[model samples]
Target: MDNLQRIDYLLHTNALDEMGKNELISILLDEYGSKIVRLAYIYVKDQGKAEDIAQEVFLKCYEKLDQYRQEASIETWLSKIAINICRDYLRSGWFKYFARGVIDTFPYLKHKETPELKLIEQMENEKLMQAVFSLPQKYREVIILHYYMEYSTKQIGDLLAIKSVSVRSRLARAREKLQKKLETGEGS
Candidate 1:
């Protein structure tokens, strides 16, 4: 069944008490935790903040489970909430002042990964990461979702509530900017 169907069924059939809530939380976190944090990181670039935002997103989802109307896919709703939270974090003065320099954050951890593969995987150059991080929010979002997370334009559109055409256009523009920056060895 689709996530929307599963979510609707769960909401309608499950107990909403602490044990039930924890079970629901486990299910959601298992499905969405890393993806949600990665989505948040595309905006904030701070691992700690991304993780905090992910936690807040799940907490909000659990709290609002009883009220969810099943109008959209659960993933879509979670992505929207996470995107909004990340925006709030970006717009806050504290983020600009105290957290801007905190960008040397850890990449997302894969619990199943061997340390050998972790060490063997080629990392993005500092210049590349800087170029990506300097992009406007929309461009950054599309780039991360499309390139890093390997989401299709249609998937990105669904997650971002934009048309796939818009997602593709934004992605093209973002690619152009990244190429120009890479060619010049600086951010465009």
Candidate 2:
């Protein structure tokens, strides 16, 4: 059988012992770790904390592998787990502290550049990212999932456990908010 089939059989048959589970988790992590980390970082706005949250999500997935119902693709299941973990992390008091700091920071740091025009471009990118990060969590989450992660509305809805209509509505709202912010230079 193929690798996915083997994983499906192992997961379904409850045959994954600790070592097997570790191997499976390793594979999944290797494939999805950067994406999860990026999602968490965008949500939390702190790289260190985002890494911690992503690790926790993977641990939960490993522990609960047998609980997967196979109603969705394994990637979808993993995305759901990651989103839930990020949401819970956002709701914590630590998130409040971090969020406040992130908002108050105003323009984010830009990469160093030798040419003046390149530096301006770097600063523009930083400003754009800061604006995105300043948006309300609901709007920011949908924007990040759709734009940054390049997830379609249906896929985002599945990962977020929301309806596709809800995802589309949120995406529209997020775009409006971002446009307004850009036009007025509010977050810049």
| Cand. 2 Cα-lDDT | 0.77
As a whole number from 0 to 100, the lDDT of residue 117 in candidate 2 is 26
**Local accuracy of candidate 2 as per-residue lDDT tens digits, 1-188:** 65666666666766788888987888778777877877776665566777898899898898888788888877778878878887887788876786667555754432222243253255458667767878988888888788777899999888877899999999999989899998888776
How does each model score on TM-score? 0.76, 0.79
Model 1: per-residue Cα lDDT over 118-164, one tens digit each: 32234566568678877888998898778777888887898788999
Question: How many residue pairs clash in model 1?
Answer: 0
For model 1, name the residue pairs that clash: none
Off by over 4 Å in 1: 1-8, 12-19, 101-123
Least well predicted 10-residue stretch by lDDT in candidate 1: 111-120
Q: How many backbone clashes does candidate 2 have?
A: 0
